[model samples]
Target chain A: MKTVIRSTTLADKLLFIALTTAAVAGIFYSREAMPKGSDVIIEVDGRTAYTLALDTDRVLSVPGPYGNTVVEIKGGRVRVKEAHCPNRLCEKQGWITRGAIVCLPNHIVISVGGKTENLPKGLDAVTG
Target chain B: MKAVKVLTVLLLLTATAVSCSNGPVEYRKTKPLMDTIVTITVVSESDRKADEAIESAFSVISRFSDKIDFFKHTSELSAVNRNAGIAAVTVSPETLGVIERALYIAKISGGAFDPTIGPEIRMWDFAKKVRPSDEEIRKNLPLVNYRDIVVDRSRSTVFLRKRGMLMDLGGIAKGYAADLALADLKKEGIAAGIVAAAGDIRAFGLKPGGEAWRVGIMNPRQKSKADELIATARLSNKAVSTSGDYERYFIENGRRYHHILDPKTGYPAAGCRSVTVISDDGIFADGFTTAVFVLGPEKGMRLVRDCGADALIIDRDGGVHTTPGLKKMVAFENGH
Candidate 1:
């Protein structure tokens, strides 16, 4: 019983250490990981910027640089998919899937959101 | 006995776990751009899918056009403009809401924030026209009266019984728009964020790591560098708007012509350079700031303090004053 308890504690310690290491590693990796191809350059009120893969556009929106300056692509139209900013003006802005996503108030520009990656997909989120 | 101890340990662990949140709920980016004389900060993050929301929020509030401005045109207010003689004619929900808030400010300012000063604003040539003669000013003076405009919230309409009466919401629209945008961000799954329209700024939730969003208060006198910063405000959802004479003004015979007009004499208020109000709604903040500017600092501070909102005031002499909340949350970078 004593040996079993010791082994259990050892396993718990190892798991905690692994999780801590993975969390730090993930942050560093995400900061450095580069897309294999061109990214869409989003221009904001002028400067504050962000970079995202095409897949991230639907879930994340950074508006000027104010409100949900959202842009969505649908039916050959690039529209502001949704926003709570009165009147859903971002929804009226229409879409841009390729180049830059501009949120003037937030100053977030996704210079790359929707480009295909020719590089092999090795490190899925789980692997990280 | 052993089972009870184990249960107690489990309860403690559960309590600790419950206290820890998932992560920092928001992110932001600030820059020095807007008027070139001041710095603009914008932060963004998502609690949901479908990005690109900020772009849509800003253009609507920031755009300056005669058309599509909720302030300039609402069905009820339009009807009032057409009816010059009625003491109070019926209006709509949008107009009624705006006018009702305008009256609140008007009463608070002791008549400084009047929505009926539309003709006076026109006479100044700040938004439209070049200028008006003294006769033109006097002729329209009688039309400016918040008392003449009544609101029936239950009926959902505003009535202007007087002729030539127009309610201009330019004072509050930007702040209101900013408030709307911030709300929109939260609705779209922004756990933490900040939104501003030129001067109307609103922040919410937590920083990306649960830290507060630090907002730098620009020095109105210097116009370069924010002399103060308001940090540690835990308000996840609120709007901050400042009205200053710096933006639009003209020189005529060595005097400045600012946009905010007092309904009494139909001219700019005597003192104060800027008045900033922070609240949960941009519309209230926007209009209150303008009205406060017209009302001057002493009363402005009282109104802000009474409403439990925060405010920063820069007097005409370049003196900076703040309400209790501003003094607590704001740090003066250079003797502010």
Candidate 2:
């Protein structure tokens, strides 16, 4: 059987090329805007409850086994604002820009996550 | 047109390529145990399976911690300390094994990392910023002899010959717990993972894409948060640990007093700022870091070579030193 085909116009080719280029550029642009600093992740009882940008200053009351673990983020740093755990070790940790702040009695873990530009392999752990 | 069709196909292909980079999702859980945050990361096909493996790993670490906790009144180590100078205290095989390793390190390190430094450690409360009196340190120094502790491997009993002598496995127990956690992960059939308990890290197998786990050594004198790491090392089926003066310390009169004490002086080891040891066994790496810190760079490197382990030492002046083996494995951040 003979096949019938429609010929493409220059305008149609230009439109298709422009759209593809724009789509590819958009993807790359989004990747660049991912995260310059990091994100504060709050986990309660083995599940994530909040993932907020570190640049934003906010106070979050995350509920856990015992009570709310008050978390504060400011100036790209995170801390345990308040916790009901008897030891208050988390509060004593003060401000941390990386790693984690854990309130064991509350079953809460606050960690920093995002792309660290220089570390291409990504840090599995930090030993001190 | 045909050109449009070709471009559409190319667009689909690009999207697929972009999304495929994220091969397998990782399941990670962090909990506070053994005086630090213990994070277990597993790359698994199913979330439920990963979660089970992680929980089992955590349970294994928790149980091991209970057996060796120096502060916990009911722990086996506590029982042994309670029976010091009295009689041999019976312990589990696991406890005996850890104690044996501690003793071995103590012998090799020439008692620099003695398990009997417990009496001195208890005197200085880092949290309260309290320092013990000179008299107290001098008194406890004599009791800090690793030779005083006797172990009976046949019967799994440990004895301290001195009345006030205390055996604190804090230096080495966490690494052993991390090693156990990794074993649990393997037993659960998790392909690749890392068990990190603060400064003690045990990594095994390649990641989902056959890449090794990368660990950063925290700079002892980090100027900023972004400049946390002095070096990074790629590890697979290995353990890397760091003992840093920065971890626990208090500054008084422009001098820093840290927790890692030299058994000879009953004071903080001042030769090095931090010592990072990499070894096939987590317990060895963890204990060696403390030993090396107290031994200084020249002597520490000798001990590292004798034990067939690698070390990265940051001296009191913030100078970087590494053994030949570690120099080949680690990538320095500042081109050291």
Candidate 3:
């Protein structure tokens, strides 16, 4: 009777150890599974002008108040190729795989990722 | 009996782990409004409640935008501009409140940030990539005086004493909208959040895990590198505003002319690459940034000191000046 009881306790302890390990692994996996953005959104004058896949390679001409701003996407990166805005600040913004390129004068903005994921974690908003 | 006790302990551990993993989540949303992107972020246990709170905040921002948008012909501000020098226009209480705050700043800044500078601002052609001739700027300078504005508190009316005197509200409107959005969020029982309109930002309460919000000040010289930070500040229940020559400007004959025009000279204010102000009031911070940028470092720091606000001013020569209080709060980035 004593041997039977000891064997049952050992079996239950093994099961408990397995369950705890699985639960800890599950928690880590969920955290790593957070979704990453696969698209880039371009807005002109506060309106969506284009939504391109990050895997695609293309050049897009977006018209704005100043003139046409040429945007290029290559190697999963997007940037302003050229701009008619006086400062050419948009063109100076070389390339972005993440984050945003904002041409305030042209009223153009290129954002990486989906709409909800545009802002990075821990940042509520960026001011200036 | 030992087996049963081990099973009970395992179940309790699992429960604790799951509960800790399901801690409060951060919800954030950004929408383009009022000529800039407005982002609101909140911490809540329920996603549905967070969505509702953000929506409420955005609605408040939209309402304020409608009241003060100068580009929109149907806006109450446009109505006021249309009736300038002809009749006193009755504005909404909110509009009156913003205008009143603007006038007060103008008074304190001594016309460094004048709302009636609209006529002068319209003279510059940033879209056309051209600078207005000095003669044209001179012709419109007389129309940019804040003293010419007349306000009737009882009637909530505003009038410009001279013809072509326009009220832009560009300097302070974003801050006012941010203030309103924060109030709306608080009303909706949001314990902590941030309301940011362009460069005007107001943070309230504490972030999840009791951490203060971290804000990065952009490197004004390196406009192309949007991720480059000149410095970072940790904030809670405060407002920060930055005015820089890089925002809107045209380079002509090797001169960079920006949008923050001086009311006295009718030209872009120079001497500082950027000016950042922090205070409890968003409107005051916004107005002071423009005012201090025009004032340069010495006088600007003096104004900041007098106003009892913290400031960081970057000069055209690549020097960084900070108030004693700000020196404690900011961490300068590499190569700053």
- State each model's CA lDDT, in order: 0.54, 0.83, 0.81
Model 3, B199-292: lDDT tens per residue? Answer: 6999988888798888777678764334456788888988999988876676888998888898999998888999999999899999999999
Error of 1 at A103 (Å): 18
Off by over 4 Å in 2: A1-97, A106-121, B1-10, B17-26, B45-48
- lDDT (tens digit, per residue) of candidate 2 on B197-287: 8779999888887888889888888776557779999999889999988766778899998888999999898999999999998999999
Question: Quick one: ranking by DockQ, best first?
Answer: 2, 3, 1
For model 1, how does the per-residue alpha-carbon lDDT over B247-274 read when each residue is reduced to its tens digit? 4555578776776677898877767888
Model 1 Cα RMSD, 1 decimal: 13.5
Candidate 1, superposed: residue stretches over 4 Å from native: A1-128, B1-76, B84-92, B126-129, B223-235
Q: Which model is ahead, 2 or 3, in terms of DockQ?
A: 2
- Candidate 2 residue pairs that clash: none
Under CAPRI classification, how is model 3 graded?
acceptable
Docking class of 2: acceptable
Using Cα atoms with residue i matched to residue i, what is each candidate's TM-score against the true structure? 0.58, 0.83, 0.78
Question: Any residue pairs clashing in model 3, and if so which?
Answer: none
